[model samples]
Target: MNAIGIDELRGLAMLPPTASGHSPFAEPCLLLRLGGTAERRLADWLRQLPCPVIGIGEADAPLAASCDVVVQNEQEAQPLLAGVRRSPVAATVLVQLLRASESLPVADALTMESLAYATLQGGAEFRRWLEGRPAPPVPPAETGPAVLLAREADTLRLTLNRPARRNSMSVEMRDALVEALQLALADDDIRRVRIDGAGKCFSTGGELDEFGTAPDPATAHAVRSLTVPGRLLAACADRAEARVHGACIGSGIEFPAFAGRIVAAPDAWFQLPELQFGLIPGAGGCVSLPRRIGRQRTACMVLGGKRIDARTAKDWGLVDAIESSR
Candidate 1:
């Protein structure tokens, strides 16, 4: 389509300008467009407009809800983001497309209102569009040794090796951890599993990068893998050890809480901010955390979404030992 053909986008308008001398972008539209000449033309138009136009770059589409216009096109869909540095667009809308041209005006594509509902309003309107999209499965590459392995006849040492992404638990890491835990559980020679991080923080909890793109079925599968192993680990809750520091949040706290003993540095802070993300403790934490700290305290910690110092964690019956290294 020609760059001038983009004027048709005016027909997809959802909001009218509140005042004269105002361009629609002043009342901005979250624009979703495939990267190409058309996208560049739209971007140029948006730049000249009198308001905020949110440009959703191809990769940052998850944050598209905050924008007003979303454009999709193949010609401008290249990953090499341009005009992004040039627009007053509140955000850009980029749909994942292959072969660049697939992003061209297709009859079977998302609508502006639907985009607003699914992304801007954070509703399920995009669920149908997302139904078939899923990350291809990894080849089960060996990421590291089993998290729990017998170092001595009576002692097991478990280390989370993903120090790069703040030790965020990827699907691969979760699976590896599960396999490690299973091996540890089956070994008659092992007595205690000592869990610690390889770097600064113990863990930042679940990986959210895959949130919108992860198909519900795969997400469910991942959830089962993450929590089932967590349940099993919690079940083997005898004389386990946790050496933690830095920000321990959500599943981080949930996982460490399951240890028979939790050792936190004096500077360590524990928190559960799942409520902020519209989720509950999925790692058997609703039962496990409450069992340790009581339902009232669990509610306080989760609902409050506040930092719980080491002393507070100890006082709430959440932690067992405070490390001296802080």
Candidate 2:
């Protein structure tokens, strides 16, 4: 929660490193603004800092690489700081977030470790709040399909059909996804499974009103583990591709992270807002996202509730490619 000015940051870098090879302020999250000549000159020292540093303004490649987060403007830094302060394990969370900024090779085993850590350290109040909300009203069967399934040669296309709701992942949508994926798994002729959303967005995340509908946490955990579309996508990752556009939020981005190929439109943006709601990503994001971009970046996204643009997502290895929206 400490906001250090650029001058102070520069001074700290010049001081002697501790026996542990970390700066004196290394234990606390440091926030600062850097640009122009100063940023370039201090790039090496900035990279060597052992603490989490949130930088505002344009940074050279070396400095940018060293920064735990680089926001284009000062306003964006506020929410990230707020998110960190709200967490019970702020230092640990910040360290994880900072580690994500580092260049690390992706490994399945490492991703699993990240998932375990996320689940174990997630806020209990967030869980209780999410599970205490009112259940959502059921959509009528006559409302047409929440998910539309079709075939085109070897490819099976699944479109989220509820444009009015921005294709929120309602119960009906989840069921439809499960069924379509199950069919795709059984059919030998279905060589590819392509997922897309109708209207403006890929999705606005899970329907908020539906939180806490499950009778108990145990049942909810079972459903999330055994029947969520994220699991289905993970099972057939090699054959699955998600063409995402617009705002891909919460479950929107989490589910697609499990796919082998994610083709995002130029205008697409990704975000994880679950932490703002006082909960971790409940829709398999902790597992799927860390697997794609490494746990550190995943931690940054979740803990900071930051919006990552399509280009950033591609650069971080979250999406395979960026293409025009169809």
Candidate 3:
């Protein structure tokens, strides 16, 4: 992908807005040439343009704050813009970043920007894959308990137990998790709550077979907002810890991020592939991930569709510690 030049960027800004209020450039990205001083009018225009703007040149705190991304020079801007231009939803993600910036904290704005990009990129890829592809057969729902409970001393240990599906977070699993958290919260004797998963991998995220099976978007939203364990874990974060191993995808990483401490095995790897399905991180990842690593890195992980190893996860402050695999 070619780096968007200054002249091209200016032309894009001059173009008429779409009926839905978006830029003309299908993959709009602004390369702002910021010298020593802050350009207020330029900044205002950049903000209004529906695309991610990268301010290249001298560092100006105020000016930097206004732009979605800032770099030292054209060289730095090239790779970043190349990556952005490759995303099918680059323009849409920029628009979302601008809106999120207005009301959210700086960290949150960055996080949202990354998520928006990831969502669009993922969604587009998913659609492409679906084209001419036969619908996959849905597996029969697993029976028996989805969560296993064990008491040790003053700690309540909850293990996700559907190994057949690699402990995918089925609705039953989510409900069971919430129930166990509630139980632990109610008992003063339970001073701590430990969460882990059974089988080869911790989890592969929410049940793929169950996607779009919800009666309606509103109902799904209600279940996610009201009943998901992400919220419960957050409320009692200080008393909660997660021991994660193997692949921790999407909600697997999102939920554990809320725990006061997250311990990852040496072989553990993390990813957020929700956007690949044309969706945001619905499992409180929008909140938890950004809080842990800041938005820029989160965006890279989500938008790049990259898997982060335990070492990288630790360096980014996503996991509190990494333990040697047994």
Top candidate on TM-score is 3
Can you write out model 1's per-residue Cα lDDT over 41-159, one digit (the tens) per residue? Answer: 33333333443333334433532222222335433322212222222121222211111112332211212212221332232323332354465444233455525344866787778
Residue by residue across 150-232, what tens digits does model 2's lDDT show?
Answer: 99999999999888788899888999999999998888999999999998999989887776566655556556554578777
RMSD of each: 17.2, 6.3, 5.1
Ranking of candidates on lDDT, top first: 2, 3, 1
Best by lDDT: 2
Tens digit of per-residue lDDT, candidate 3, span 1-326: 33444455445556543321334245356556654444466456656666566666554544565566666777766655545555436434534554455457534443454445334433554455335346767655667789999999999999999987888888889999999988987888998999999988899898876666666555555455557687778778899999999999988898888899999999999998654564556666666787898655565565446798999999989999998752
lDDT of predicted model 1: 0.51
Cα displacement (Å) at residue 129, model 1: 17
Q: TM-score of the candidate numbered 1?
A: 0.54
- Give the least accurate 10-residue stretch of model 1, judged by summed lDDT: 90-99
Instruction: Report the poorest 10 consecutive residues by lDDT, candidate 2.
Output: 17-26
For all predicted structures, in order, the TM-scores are: 0.54, 0.68, 0.75
108 Cα displacement, candidate 3 (Å): 12
Q: How badly does each model clash, as a count of residue pairs?
A: 39, 3, 1
